[model samples]
Structure formats: structure tokens, C-alpha cells
Target chain A: MKFTKGRLLEKAKEISTPRARRMSMTINKTDFRKSMKKLVDSEGFKHLSTITGIDVGPKIELIYHLTRENLVLSLKVKTSKKNPVLPSIVNLIPGAVLYEREVHDLLGVTFKGNLDLSPLLLPDGWPSDVYPMRKEWAPQDIRKAMEKP
Target chain B: MATRIPFGPQHPALKEPINFMCEVSDEKVLSVRPRLGYIHRGVEKLAENRTYNQNLYLIERICGICAFAHVTCFSQAVEEILNIEIPSRAKYIRTILAEMERIQNHFLWLGDVGHEMGFNTLFMYSWRDRELVLQLIENISGKRVNYAMNTIGGVRRDITSMIMPSLKEGLNHLEERAKYYTEMCTKDPTVLRRTVGVGMLSPSDALELCAVGPTIRASGIPRDVRADDPYAAYEEIPFKVITYDGRDVASRLMVRLDEVLESISIIRYALDNLPNGDVRVRVPRRVPKGEAVSLVEAPRGEDLHYVRADGTEKPVRVKVRAPTLANIPTLCKMLIGENIADIPVVIAGIDPCIACAERLVFVDTATRKRWMWNKQELRKYATKWYRKK
Candidate 1:
């Protein structure tokens, strides 16, 4: 039922309908930019609510939630946790700039085309590769690491 | 030739730790580069370790002013995963507290704006009047700032007869004052001169830049989470999504003032027609494996929360997107092509909660005549600049 309403956005790899107001679809990392650009231009999903990146073992899942009217469509993409790299969506939706930086700072996903992926949510002098949001980093370890030179 | 200025970490106006590196030529601001993350608490990283119920208190502390909004968003998301609807009485009570919170937050913002523009009289007046709502909230919630009023399934406390009368009386006073302040802001030349036609953000820019709450509403967009996505009893309580075409600092002030009035009516309606039922419902300790997105119209703007459960007491992931973070990019957009003197007013115009949003302080030096001014000197310069005009 939800797919018919959003048939245009459907080269969707897999559909998972949750509740009724929000729907989540998993798309290949390769198809993410193409789908989001179309979602912005023709489908009126200009407002990028937020981008959530979660570290789920071997992969970091990045969900970009876009809203139009009352419906929220989240496009989920997973990249390898060892070296997570995804194309930036700043050119399509300008508001995704900060959200992308935040994802990079915490989960260590590098957006290839982002102008400044420099630590957004992390403090100024934070270490380059110490991404705290990954599952393995404990609170004490992060605190100790932050205190170092 | 242009020189760069570091605006904060110890604010001149906002009194918070946040910085904006502005390139200035004479008095005109050429461009703005913002540095945030001074107080990043790693709340999301911590949430992954704590249980679902324990996260309620932890998440509530995300913002002092919008404490209830944060909890409401968090609880609603968790409840969705649990798939148990809260009772009608709880929904109505939650709506009242949320609107009451909006009233107090807007009043606080008005005081901050007044302080920023160097009109301390407006500051004194708005803050003094703000106590009525705060006292009313204190009476119901026991603790003022962190109410802890909302739980996963429902609200914690009920609005009793003892608190209800005072709540009604306080709304009457706040309504009158909201209107009076509106008239004062629109009429007073000092206020008008500092605010009117300053920090202009067009409707299109506001939308594309993802501005929210009064900031976007001021720019003539009626996108409100309360009206659009009806959380609590907001759909039942009749209210208008106030918007102004002014698209400037003046419009932002008017939008917040009008929202205070609107919130008052929403509270009054919720109270009068409140449904009778149990305030809370019991749910199992473990939530089924699911992910749900919840939204609440916080005092500042749309507050978004997402919860992922692995059929355990502890959540797998919890994400919080505060309104100020969304507004910061838009704030940067508005600051360009404006004078240095107008910086404080424009920054204050967004109603930034910098602790939750970001913070950083740095200065860049080169072959130039550097006018190193912190918030005090800049605010004084702004006041004097307007006074001499």
C-alpha cells in the first residue's frame, strides 16, 4: 500500500513498513544519492529531518529520514564498519551538511564530496581517528583518550 | 581588507559557550564560519548502554528549558516500540505541560532577545512576568526544570484540583502580558530600530536551510510539529500555526510572543475538556525488537527522537536531533551580508540553546589591524552604533 503511493521512489532494494506514519526502506549505498536527489527534486522531500548513523557490528547503518507533509520516509544504507565511506547529499539537500558531519564525527563515516567533514560534534582538539560512537569504545576509554595530547 | 572576529565560548550576549568566526570589513560582516561542539556530552553513546526506562531521566537533561519536550519525544518513541497507547488523561496532561513549557520558553527567549539588543528593561519585564508559568509548572511537577513528568507508557502525575485553579489564573495573566509585550515590541522605536528589517531570511531560504519553530514561522512557514504530527492531545486542542511574512528579527520576536498567547489557549482548552481516565498504563519490562521515530514540537522547534530496541530492556541505539542544531546552519545563512553591530541580535533571534547545539572559541590572526572584541565590546559597540544614529 505504501509503495503504490511512493512508486516513483521505488527502486527500493527492500521495503519495511513500520506503524503507519513512517516507512523505512533499505537501499544500496550506490543508489542512495540517485534516490535522495529524486526524492528532493520531484517528490517534495526537501526537508531533511535528520540523519542517524548506528554502528551495528561489522557495518554502520546510515538512515537519512526525509519528511514531506505528514509522512516520513527513511532511506537506510549500510557500509562496512572497517572503512565506511558514502557519497555526501549536500548538493541535493543543503540541510544535510551538519547531519553528515555529525555522522562522520561519531560513527567515522567519510562522505566523499562533503566540503568540510572536520569534527562537527567533537571538541576542537579531538584525535583524528577516535570515533566514540562505535560499539567498542567505552565511556571511560573515550574520556581518557579525550584527556590526552 | 577584512579581519576575522571570534564571537564566543564566553558570550557577550547569549552568556553561553559558542563561537562564530566572522570576517568583517569596516562594520560590515563579509562571511560567517561557526565552530560548535564545546559541550558534547556523548548522550547518544551513553544511551546505548542504559536500559529503556533509565534513559528517561538521562534524556530529559538534554535541554533544561525543553526538558519535558525531550522526555516526551523519547518516551513516545520507546512507547511506540512497546506498542501500548497511553491513556487519554495522560495525553491531555502531557499536552498541558508541553504547552506550559512553550509559554515559559518563549518568555525566556524574549528576555534573552531584550538583553542582547541592550534593552535591559525589556529583559527585566519579560523575565519578571515569566515566573507565573514557572510557578504554575512547579506546583504540578514538584520539580520545575526536569519535571520527570513523563514515563514510557504515560505521564507520572495528574493535574489535581489544587493546581488546576492556579493554572487557569496564571494563564489569564500570561495572556494579557503576552498581548502587552506584543504591542510594546511593535510600537517601541528602540525595539523596532534594533530588530526591524535586520537578519532577513526569505521563506525559500528558511525552508531549504531547514530552519524550525519560530525561526521558520517568522519567515512565513507554518510548518509546526504539533499541527502537522499530532502528538499527545495537540490534535484535540484547537490552535493556529502562527506565521509572519516579515522574515526578519522583528518577525521572530512577534512569532514567539504570539506563540505564548497560542500556547496559553491550548493549555486552557486541554484543561477544560480533559478526559477522565488513568494517567499511566503498565507495560512489560522488555520492549519487542522494533524501531520507531517520534517527534515533539519543543519550545524552540521540532524535536526528533529515534529509538531502536533489540527486544531487551536496553536500547540498541537512541538518537536526538535538537532544534538548535537544525537552526545553526540557517543562523549561519542569516548572518552573512550583515553588519558586525547587528550580530548579537541576529544570533539571539534564533533562540539558540548552545549547550545542546554546540560551542568552540578560536581567533585567526594575519597581517591586519585586528579589533579583538568579545561579547561585551561588541554589544556595547552595537548599542553605541544605534545610539549615535
Candidate 2:
């Protein structure tokens, strides 16, 4: 079934919140999971390509990318660094395993029940407790630390 | 008991540095654990600091080979966010450059695959012919490696009629060479012996694993981002997504070869029907606060980029999901129980870019060790340690 951009927006509006229909949403992690699962089952959104995490001053926003009937649905979840955990979607989409692991590894967010969260792209001896993508670290600091024996 | 052997981080045969640890039992791979993040430069983090215009150059540097695709996708995402429409002629130009990149990339992969199988003659033949495509790219973009042609609103360069004749001749030469190489590789008994039915990925496996590009097509699953989800001038231009039901290294090779032919055809069509208009549209300086995802068929498979902007000079977040990253897990799955000697051929089957694969960083709890390896090094180590007894 082919869907034009307008039809997709309309379908999204019928099922998702107004914010989600506009390709954005702000929901708790638990509600985010439910909304995503609902979209998956009803809309046949089988593909979860990757998860994008952003630190928005006071909160971390998690974007779950989903595609259904030719339209992309990005489900957003906001959480604080104090308790950064989200439900694992590995069970829903097997291909998302590596992507989920990556979100866990880089953003320091835990995906509960994520299998094989082992080191993927990072090296074996990479220092812990330091997230390179965090805005605070300087490039010189990373280079100096990397140059260390 | 199975012994675990570490294959990379530094090794010959791998063009880039990548590390893999494999468990071998009697010369057969029992399981493989890939250690990545050796070369994570924090491109996403870097995107955070750079202005929207400046990030264009940084995104192009994501991978030298797929630089065009990365910039094109990034540009498209930013354009979509700004709700700007590119000129029709610019769209056609972007399509032409993309197909050109595809031709050169597939040729590069062909040569690499031949070298992997110890067929240096084929490698030399493929690379020698690939120069023609590269020359054409240099003629159009003025730079070979990182063609900074794609801009936020449209393309930085235009395809004028002055170069139309040369482009057509180049396409003709490439088509002839593609045919010759495809026949030589597919008909040769040694090539067939090494590739046919080796590292089989069933259709179900390909779909379930969400394999893209030639990897999925080799398994008889026809899913091309260009055709399935049309972007750029692909909607106007017509091209077939080639596939093979064999689901082996040979099948993947054939799929790419046929795709070379299809890309050539598409380029010819786009150039012949090239539209005339302004080269670019002016995009707003600040994008609205929203998120957009753009997918393009990077010479490899599906190249995805997600951009979130909060009406600022820098993006709030940027995530790039290259095709090689998605195919790695599936490649690891195919490596199991295969002869150690065939590892390189299977690994090259995906035509992976290790630089793109190492986009994420991992923290090691035990020794506090952090290092990154590019794609080439990873394969060399896997073959050297695992292929050798």
C-alpha cells in the first residue's frame, strides 16, 4: 500500500498524539514504549533503523525512528540523566540490536534487557565514565588522553 | 575447547584498522566477536559544535569513499527541515553525481573482492577501468575524494551542456568495461569456485536482519532505497533494482555488477532529460525546531541521517547510520561455520566501510582501554589470525 505524505500525516494524527503527528512527541519512557508498540502492531512499522539521543539542557531526548507505509514516525522520549533507562526494543526488531547497543554505549543510557551490549565500535580498552559526545569535554583533552599510554 | 584469536586493531590485508576476535574450532569459525569504536571521531558530537553550514564539510568527511552520499543526505535533511525546494536541474545534477559515485564505488569493491580472493589480475583490471569513472568525477567536481558539491539548498556545481558529450562517452566506456568484468568474474571457474554458494544468506535471514543494497538483493530480496523510497531525482529517473537468488558471495558480486549497469542507465537518462533551472534555492539560516530523517542509497546500501534542530546554528542532535554498520551483524552471522580461508571474500561481500562502522564509542570497564580501527585493518586481522591455523 502506497501512502502520500499527506495521507501518512493524517493516519498518524488518527493514531498518535498531535505532537507525534507533527513528527515530534514528548512522552515518558514507559508511555513511549506503549505508543511505539501500538504503532508497530497497527501500522506495520517493522523497521527501527536507529535511535538518536540529544542532551537538551535539563533533559535527554530519545528519538525512536520508525517507518510504516512509506512515512517515518519518530517517537520522542525525554528523561533526565538521574535515571536514564528506556525499554529495549530489540525484541521487536532484531536488526536494532547493534543500534540499541550503540545508544547505550555512547549516551550512557541503559536499555534494559539489551543482549550483547558488549563493545561494538569502541576499542577494548576505552576509558569508562567518559562519554566523548558530551558537550563538556574539549578535543585537546580527548586527544591527550588517547595519546596516553 | 575452542580457542579465541584476536584478529585486528593492527594487521596487514585490512586496508583500515579494525579488530575482531573469533572462536575457531578445527579451522571453522564457531563465533565471532567484533571489537569496534577504534576510530570513532565523535562526528555526532562534532556536529553539535559546528554551525549548520560548517557541519556540511564535517559530514562529508565521515567517509572518504561515501562522502558524496553523506553530504547529499545531510543537505537533504537540512533542506527538508527548512522546507526549501531545490531547483529541478540541481536535483538532476545531484542524481548524476550520486550514480557516478555508485559506479566508482562498486568498481572499487570489485577490485577489492578480486584481491581478497587472490585474483590480482582481476583486481588490476577492475581498478584500471575504475579510473575512468574517477576521472569523470574529478572533471565535474574538481576534487576526487571529497567532492564538496552538495549544499544545504541544492548542489554547489551544475552539469552544463559543455560536459554532456564527455559524460556520455564516459558512461559508454564504463558500460563496456562493466560488461567485460562481469563476464570475466562470473564465467571464470576459479572465481565461481571461491564465491558460488559460499557464505549463503537466505532470503528470510536477509529480511529478518534488515540487510540492505546488494547484500539483501543477493538473497533475492529486492529492496533499494532509491526505488522503494524515492529521494532526489530518483523519482523522475527510472532504474531497476538488480537482484540474485543465489545468496552467496558470487550473487552479491553479480548484484553489484548489474547495479553498475543500472546506474549507468540512470545517469544517461538523467543527463539526456536534464532540466534547466537555477542551480540552487536559498534555505533559511535557522531551521525550525523539529526532527527529520533522510535515507539515500549510498553505494553500499541504505545511508540514513537523522537531524534535530532547535532553531539554532548548530543541530541539537545528528545521527548517521551507515549501511555497513547495519550489515556487520549479518556479516558476523554468515561467518559462522564457514571455512577460514573464505572469510575475506565474505567480509568483502558487504563492501563495508570500517570508518563508517566505527561511528559509536564504547567504554571498557575492565582495563580502561579505548581505541578505534578503520574497516581495512579489521579484515586483515580476521584473515591473518583466523585463516591461519
Candidate 3:
């Protein structure tokens, strides 16, 4: 099947916002896996390029960037920062394992079914409860903690 | 018994720091689990603190080999957020520098591969020719490694007529060397023995694993960010997306070598059709609230950046997805079921950049006093020492 941004929007039209040469849309937290599965199964998205997680106040947003030919489709999902657990897409795209691990380490998000999330980009002995990427820790607080001899 | 072998945070074969816990049974491998984050500097977190313009300097240092790729990607995203159109001349100049970086980077990777395979002659020759590309870069941008050429709306530098003659001469020499290396990689028996059929990755596996750049192209997939989604002057310049179906180390080497030639031609085209205009326009310090995605074909593969602004001078979030990180899983796929002796070659075959892949620590072993330094301490020291020098 010829995969294009238009074809991807057809399946998740309610969530997708069309941009120039690309489509950006926010899917419900529950529909992320199924929406991604349908797109991949239909060959509408040939590649799971990268998954980026950003912490925005009380919620954490996850952006899944998928590409095919010249078209890019970004799927966004927001999970509450209090319990930022989302479904693992590794079963659908095994390449997402590392990215998931990275997001988990930096932002305190959990991807269920991702068995090996024991720190992908953070060193050992790093404080387990501290998510450095989250905004709750002010620059001064992190500096003070790191500076304490 | 499946004896586990630890391959590095430091090893003779690895150019950067990475550890792979390989479960092996009598020299055959079972599974390799990679431990990363030894070099992660919290650049994403750092970007949230720096302004849009300052982030270029911060992001470009993520990978020295693909420094231009980082800046270009960051600049493109910021420009998109501001909704500003860069001049045609700036786009052409950006393409020229990006391709120059590819040539130098491919040369460096080829040399590293040769060293991995115990081919010292290949190592020496590739680095020697790579200096030529660096010289051309130095002439254009006044620096070699971190060419801070990309600015917000466009590039910071321009190629004048004064340097065109020597630039063409250097490119011609590079083209000849690339052609020779391509021939050597394909026909040399010693190279074939180590590379041919070793670390084989089929097209389907490459796709499923999300391999980018020449790694995926080597597996018979012609997906190139430059061709697939034309950025900078790529839409205007003509160049073939080189691919090889060898599905092994040899194909990967051949793909990069051929790409060097393609980059040379693209550079030539950009220079010949050089547009006349201001190289850059002043952009506002504060970017309006919006999000932008910028994708560029870095030397290794597709370099992706996502920047979100909140109508402030600083970005709300900046995410950099370097190419090497995407290729790591594919590296694991290639390593399994392979002979332990070919580990170095196979690993180098992916052009793994651990610096771009993980979080790192610092140890001063010379004093026999080993205490790990935090990312901020090391970054401050490195920046102060380097900039002062």
C-alpha cells in the first residue's frame, strides 16, 4: 500500500491535525496502541522513527514520530504526570524498546510490558525517584543537590 | 554454560564508551544487552534552560562528527516555529556544509572500520584524505570539528568566489579517492573475507528495527531523508540515493563510500547554481508558542529534532533524536549468532556513536583517585578548558 500522510489521517481523522507535508494529532491515551497498530498494519507508516516525551506541568506528553516516503505523521498521547504509565508499543515495533527506556529514565514515565526498563540513559546510583527531565525540580534545587558534599 | 562477557565502557576496539553484556556459548552469541547513558549530558534538559539561539551551540556538541547536522536540524526547527522563510542562498550554503560534514564523517567511519578489521593501510589512507575535506571546511567556515555555521533563519557563513577554485579542487580530489575506496572495498579479497556476509541484516529486519542512513540503505532500502523529505537545498540539488543489497558489512561500507561521491556532486551543483541574497535574517529572541519537527539526513542516518516553544525566550522542550540511537537495536540484531571475533567489525559496521547515544561519566585515573564526576561538572570543566585554550 502507498503510505501517505493523507491515508494515515483517514484512520485517525478525529485526532489528526493536518500541517504542511505532515500530520500532527492527539489521540486519546487509550487509543494510542490501537491507532498505531492500524497504521503500521496497513503499511501507512513504514517506520517508527523515534518516540519523544516532554513534561508539561501536571501532564507528560508522548509524541510518536512515524515516517513513510516523504510523509511524517506525529501521534501525541498525554498521560497524567502523577501516574505516567502508558502502553508499550514494543510488541508492535520492537525498535521502540530503547526509546521507551529513555523516556522512563528521564521523565518518570512507565511503559507497561517493557520488561527491561532498568535505566537506558541514566547511570547507576542515580537517585531512583528523581526524574531530572521533569520541571518540578528547579535549576537551583538540582544544583544544590548535586553540590552537597 | 552460557558464559557472559562484558564488552566495554572501555575496550580496545571501541572508539567511544559503551558496554554490551554478551551471553556467549563457546564463542557463539546468544543475546547482547547494551548498557547506555555513560555520555548523556541531559542536553534536552539543558535546552529547556537556554534560549533558542544558545541551544544551537549546545546541541551541535552532541556529536562532533555530525556537528553541522545537529545545528542544521535545530536551526530548521526554530525557523519553522518563527514561521520565517530563509533565503535561498542560506539554504544552499547549509546544504554545502551538511554534505561536507558527511564526506568527512564517512571518511572517519571508514578509517575506524579499517582499524577494527586490522587494515591499518585503510585507516591511514582514509584519514589522510579526510584532512582535505576538513581543510575545505576550515576555509569555508573557519573551523574544522564544530562548524557553528547554522543560525536561526539561515546560515552564519557564506561561500565567496575567492574560495570556489580551491574548494572545487579539494572536492575533485575527494571524488577520486572515494571512487578508489569504493573499488577497493568491493574487490579486495581481505576486505571481502571480513565484511562480505558478515553482520547480515535483511531489508525487513532493517525496517522493523528502524535502521537509518546507510545502514538501512545497505539492506536494500532506499529511504534517505534528503531524498524522501528534501530539506535545505536538497529539493533543488540532484543526487542519487545510493543503496546496496549486499546486506552485510561490505554493503554498508560500499553504501557510505558511494555516498561520498554523491555528496561531492551535490556540493558541485549547489556551488554552480549559487543564489545571490542575504545569508541570514535577524530572528526574534523570543519564539512564539508552537512546536516544530526538523529532520535532516546526517552522515550516519536521519537526524531528528523536535522543539516546542511557549512564547518565551527559552524553549519548553527540545528533543534530539540522534541517528546512532536509532541504529542501536539494529546493531543488536546483527550481533547475535555471529562469531565473537567479528564483534569489533560488526559493531563498527553500524558506525555507533556512543557519545550521541548515552549518558557518560568522568574519571581521572592517572592519579589512582577515581571518583565519578557529574554531567554538569564535566560539562563546565570541558567548556571552560576548551574555550580558554
DockQ of each: 0.78, 0.48, 0.71
TM-score of each: 0.96, 0.88, 0.91
Give the candidate order by descending DockQ: 1, 3, 2
Between prediction 1 and prediction 2, the one with superior TM-score is: 1
> Runs in model 1 with CA error above 4 Å?
A1-6, B11-15, B354-371
**Residues A1-149 of candidate 2: C-alpha lDDT, one tens digit per residue:** 35454443332322332222234444565566666666666667776667787776666777777765455567677777767788787776777788877876776678887867876766666676655655555566767766777
User: Which whole-number lDDT from 0 to 100 does residue B192 have in model 1?
Assistant: 97
Of the candidates shown, which would achieve the greatest TM-score relative to the real structure? 1
Better of 1 and 3 by lDDT: 1
Q: Compute fnat per model.
A: 0.69, 0.56, 0.67
Better of 2 and 3 by DockQ: 3
Which candidate, 1 or 3, would have the higher TM-score against the true structure? 1
User: Lowest summed-lDDT stretch of 10 residues in model 1 chain B?
Assistant: B355-364
Model 2 lDDT at residue B344: 71
> After best superposition, candidate 2 residue B136: deviation in angstroms?
0.6
Tens digit of per-residue lDDT, candidate 2, span B65-103? 889999999998888778778999898999999999999
Order the candidates by TM-score, highest first.
Answer: 1, 3, 2
How many steric overlaps are in each model, in order? 3, 21, 8
